[model samples]
Target: MKNNINIPKEKLNQAVSRGIEKGRQEKPMKIRNSSMIIKRVASVVVIGGISLGLTFPVVVQAFPNIESAIIDFVESVLPKSYSNKLKHESKKNNIVISDGKAIVTLENSTLDNYQFIANMIIESDFFKQYEESDLEHNLYANLEVSIGDNKNIVGWGAHIRKIDDNKASLVVTADVGDIKLEDNVDVYIKLQGLEIQSNEWKSNDIKELKGNWDFSFKTDKVESIKRINIKDEIELDGKTMTLESIEVTPLASYIKLTADENISDKWVFASYKIVDNNGKAYRNAQIDGHTDEKAWNFTIAIYDDLSNIESLKITPYTDEQSIPSKIHGQDIIKMTTTMDEGSEVEDIIVSRPVEKRDLNVDAKPAHKYEGEKISYNLNIDKEKKFYTIDELIGKSINTGDGTSVTIKDITVNDKNTTIMLKVNGDYNVLSQVVLFDEDMRDIYSGIYVTHKGKWPSNSHWNNAKDTHYASGLATFIIDKIDVNKKYKLAVPIQKEINLNSGHTMNINLK
Candidate 1:
């Protein structure tokens, strides 16, 4: 084959050189004939064999079996760890275990029912082992298992297998809504890597289990029984009564009660009493009640005497008969009573005075009247009437001259009415003369007395020596007066007098 191939190559090269020489002989008439000859020779060698090998090199074409080729390619491209993992997964897919009855259904005709059944068995076992290894100590004890999206089981279905002496593997399958367990129990579930969404949790007996619970996701509602376990013994009037449902919240210290009517209207006609464990009447126990529409709500603070009140008795009075009902052994009680027609309840709280005591007992001094020297005399032994200094001052009257006239030795009903006058050292003239009663009203005129005294000059009065004249007759009518009561008497004295040369005088009455 090599000799034949080399022979074709040599003959092709000779044919090319002959064609070039023929071209050169035919084109000898031109001056470029020699250059054309040389060019033809180089082209023949290059295109004929040596350059053909350098440009279009040889390539061997051989193929192995198709299956083995694919396998080898896959193995060569993938990492050793990944390749081993795929092999392990393929082996795991073949081995199947079912924790419960495996239900297989084909909704779409494209899916193979047998293949789905196998897949579910594998998934169930995987979840079972996962839950057993993960959540053994959780409070939720029961377990259920299911496979695929089917309605074969309406409720929870679970299966268990013995794993060890003390522990067991469990598989659970249930819907994502409305799941509940019995009291004091918990349920743990694993659905491969699927998430669950639920709303409510409820139990029949909250007292036994204690209404305390924890949840992982937000739910719509949870119901549980709240128990009031009495710490101390209480006396009940009856065996049992329908208790009003009260909303009890977690971690709250006090119990709250709501009513449908005004508390005053409901409790007013109902006589209620609360006694503590010691059986003492509570004092100042506050009872507050409010009204909402036709209903009454009341809150009563419990005290120590009212403290630990294990019993409460209520009595209602009616026209037909008196009905007495008792609610016993409850810290918080709520009830309603009807009000009588045309009758109303009144506030029963009363006001009382707080006690106080007196402490001091000392006397104060009397007040002195402000005036110049004035005189007064009283003769109660002779008159059987009262006379005070104010009455004497009322009898005095001012004269136009520098002197004033006053009654002397005035008597009323045999009582001596004495009088005295106060003359300032600067007073030099008098204005008018009139006698006034104790009320300061003019009762008599002292004109006659002033005219009788006559205007006397300081020189002519040298021998007078500030003398006072008195008359034994009654000078002014007087009315009965009380000594304890204060009275004012007005007497007009000197007016507008120039008394640069001051002089003093005195007048007396007896």
Candidate 2:
């Protein structure tokens, strides 16, 4: 069976020549390795006691007869949720094929109604010739796996574990495209060459380690596919948006929305989620794409049974706001002060129904300005439902510059709570703000202050302003707060950009 697998003549010749050298060696060759480095700030600090409960109603059952070797490999590589699903749905498939230099063993595969996964191991003595320079973003960046005729299935994700210094096991997954699989039809599995990312993280180098690693398997048809289409209209802030369709399957729910051509103001939503009739909340809502100038699409992964949901109520943001940006790190100030750990300062009170202004601030060139003086009683246990009060200012340190962020006032009304802030020195300092409980533990960390207007489409707040100061609001949905309990706020002194290497994958089942 191995002799029948096809390999390009050049790759076969290279493998044979390398094999001759391996035949004479006393032991396998070793390659010097340089691992990838990732830099990120801790988003959440799990302090003592306080915990937020996030739950989904999915029932997971273990799949019997899985190979112990493959189960161990899969658990090591994939995410906990994905690994659990794979374990429950996988079937054992023991198939081995080699191309003289590297041996690949297919251990198990899972075929869900909408997804497919393959688990395998690759043992290659030839890999020793390449050193750390041949490594990619991590390890496995070059490993390729596919299924169906003509390599129709490209892998969506892969988890790899190096067993020894030379061999590795990989689990690859794909979202089986829109095309339905036929019963007993041949499903071809193929492993292609590997790519290595250079120092610049670009795929400029590829190792042509080719082989005839192929297998044929039969698949029984799946019956769990389900979908629903609903054309519903939703109104927000006097603007109308249409929910064109809602698709529900075992894995996810897809929602489509479109705007009317006559509408002038475009709407965007944040903290959006669907609550079913049973009061269970699902917050997996993600913006998939903007279909056109007037339309948008989204996807929400549903882990529970679709039938368990009778109706859904969705929360959408109606009000949009914008703030301009300012220059940073110029004429920086420094100050050191001492205060009681939990002290009460001063407060300026305003009348009820304070003047509400539209969030759209006009764009202008950056300028330095002395912001208005703000003061507030540092009281966290005010029982007033709404506080029209003076700003509670905090000093932040950024690159030797002391910037000030003032919480102008606090409003607790309805289910939405907003924190209005004025940036006196620099807007970048407010990039990270955390609400900490008494023990210096986080109640909410990594809170992003987003604008509603069209100026700053990018995620950065600095793009919205070129001035010396800016003001914006961060809104959150909560039922009620325990104001009696003490809390503290923390913000970064300098601007920070969390480094992220973006890699994309496309899945087309059809």
**What is candidate 1's lDDT per residue for 1-510, written digit by digit as tens?**
001011233443344334334432000111111211211100100000000011101100111122232233223222222223223322122111223422111000000100000111111222232221121111122222222322222123222322222222222222221123222222222222221111112223111111111111111122222324322211122211121222221211111223333223322332223223333322111122223344333222221221224443221211211112211211111111111223332311111111110000111111121121111111111212223534443343332233334433222222212222333222222222223333333221121111113321111111111121101111122232333333323233223322211111111110
Among the numbered candidates, top lDDT falls to: 2
Candidate 1 steric clashes: 24
Candidate 2: where are CA atoms >4 Å away? 1-85, 88-90, 126-137, 141-155, 183-186, 202-208, 233-300, 304-310, 314-510
Candidate 2 on 1-510: residue-level lDDT in tens? 001112243443354335434432000111111121111111111000100000000100121111333353343233233445434433445566667667666655655444455566566864554432121122432433334554554324444444333445665554443335664334566566443323222236444555566667754433445555556666554556566555554334545455444433334333243456665544232323223344443333333344656676554443211122221212111111112334343322211110111111232211212221111112232322221122123322122133445554334443223333444332333443434444433332121322222222111121111111101222222222344454444344332222111211111111
lDDT, candidates in the order shown: 0.21, 0.36
Name the Cα RMSD for model 1.
59.8
lDDT of 2: 0.36
Clashes of each: 24, 17
> Which of the numbered candidates is closest to the native, going by highest TM-score?
2
